[model samples]
Target: MSAAVERARAMIGVPFRLHGRSRAGLDCVGLAALALGREAPGDYGLRSGDVARAEGWLRAAGLRPVAQGRPGDLALARPGPLQLHLMIGTGAGFVHAHAGLGRVVEMPGVSPWPILGWWAVE
Candidate 1:
């Protein structure tokens, strides 16, 4: 497993807080940034702005889209073109902050959410 995925696994059970970005609490994007060790753009709520922000960071990291996610890969969940959520791949599953669950967790599958795309971190 990648160091990034190990880092992300360390975050399981962290409380979910919208727009938050700390061990105390974090949103999905915050979790991604934590996992990937990247500085994500400022917080935005339910908009294409979030997607753009994530894309910018991923591009800056030189991440490339992949058909299948590997351990520590980034999985973007998009219910629409605009709204996006980020998760860290664990190979067996994924880890992400869930607002509804009010915590970060490791799910059993490639993704618990619909994948818009999977990006492999170089």
Candidate 2:
């Protein structure tokens, strides 16, 4: 597996918490920051802004935007460094933290949600 995928998978079972980003507890955005080792902006809320804003922030971070997510792109779907949806791309799936599931989980297939964009981490 790719390093990003492996790192994200290692976070499986971590508890979900709003604005959380640690191994003990992590929200979606937090999970992405931890896996990518980058500081995400605070205004990045999951439901706060449109996908364009989210994509703009990630682009400002020097993360290359890809037309499609590959096996190691970092995924984001909210605002704030700790309060958004975060995941790691794997060719066939993605690893992310889910509030409903109460832990990080590997989801097979590209996310059906409208993704803002993907950050190449590997």
lDDT on C-alpha atoms for all candidate structures? 0.80, 0.72
Tens-place lDDT digits, model 2, residues 11-61: 888898777878888877787777776776787746665566677767776
Model 1, residue 57: distance off in Å is 3.8
Q: What does candidate 1's lDDT look like per residue over 13-94, in tens digits?
A: 9999987789989888788878888776574454563766666667776787888887898888875566778888887888
Which one wins on TM-score?
Answer: 1
Regions of model 1 farther than 4 Å from truth: 43-46, 49-53, 79-82
Model 2 lDDT-worst window of ten: 77-86
Report how far off residue 70 is in candidate 2 (Å): 1.4
Question: How does model 2 fare in lDDT?
Answer: 0.72
Residue 41 error for model 2, in Å? 2.2
